[model samples]
Target: MQPEIQLSNSTTQLESTQNKVLRNTYMMLGLTMIPTVIGAYMGLNINFAFMAQHPILSLLGMLAVMFGMFMGIAANRNNALGVVLLLGVTFLLGLMLGPILQAALHFNNGAQLIGMAAGGTGAIFLTLSTIATVTKKDFSFLGKFLMVGLVMLILASLANAFFQVPVASLAISAIAIMLFAGYLLYDVSQIVHGGETNYVMATLAIYLDIYNIFVNLLNLLMALSGDRD
Candidate 1:
């Protein structure tokens, strides 16, 4: 009986910690969007592709973005500087997203499609996040497999850009949504299990997961719903 009581108390404490981390993570995630929007607006207005014209420059730009992402994740363990850098990185991401946004806006129903995509993305995030919290399932086992799959997805996308394979694009988008939704579950469960304590880092992981999911979903939706006329 005494051991059972102790076990119950420990469970309660863990739950309390999980709730706190989840709350803080969400608060920070919400805050990070301000800079992202500002960056997107600036990038759009300036027509900043960071890789628009020169192929070599575009490759270099991608490398730089990857470096920034690595630094943001690694630095997150130590200081608030990580949080600042994460926002900066996200702003750059928004800039990168601008091209897609621009393309989406070109369609007659583009604005409506964007709204629909955003709504769909929000629904998936909320549903998956709630499931992760309620079930307390550990999805970390998916990390390595998903990473490998993402690499393949990237390679396939580059190949398709050259080959212009419509089927390949559909396949990539489907895989991306699945992978990132899994990523969302893993990220949230980390907070729930106290595997992640820093709100900035937590927010970064979840935000990236959410962003990828939304972008891929939007791509799929646009392909299907876009009116080329």
Candidate 2:
């Protein structure tokens, strides 16, 4: 009887912790979109011709900044400072979207494609998150496989950056869409199953998943159906 009672109490505590983490993560995630939208809007108005001309340098610079912010956020994950750093990183990511957004907006149906991509990303996130929450399955098992895929995807992306092959770009975009969709499930499951106790860190992981999914989805859509002026 004593052992059973202890087990029940342990389960209850874990559930409570998971609930709190999920709630805070969601609130922070919602807050993050505000800064992202503002930055993206600003990015749209800015001229990124230099980045367009010097793609590799631009990519390296963005990666370096993102790495720095990631380190900052990781170092501060226990306090509100993490939240601030996460928002800063998101804003910078939004600004980095300028070149791609500018390119997309040049197409006749660019706005529609962007909207579709956003809708698709939302749908995927909603479905995966719902599944993870409702089923409460342990998705931590996915971590290793997903990391391997991510590393490979990064290598392919870097290679294609210099090769500038249209087919390789399309393939990379397709693979990225699949990989980050997997991340959506893995990330949300981590939150629900007590694998991730810090909501701030959880929000950052999930945000990256959604961000990558949206960007790659938009790229694929544009490649498939972009209308030229």
TM-score, every prediction: 0.87, 0.97
Clashing pairs in 2: none
- Which numbered prediction scores highest in TM-score against the true structure? 2
Model 1: lowest-lDDT 10 consecutive positions: 48-57
In the order shown, the candidates' Cα RMSDs to the true structure are: 2.4, 1.0
Look at candidate 1 and give me any clashing residue pairs: none
Cα deviation of 214 in candidate 1 (Å)? 1.5
Per-residue lDDT, model 1, residue 51, is 53
lDDT of each: 0.81, 0.91
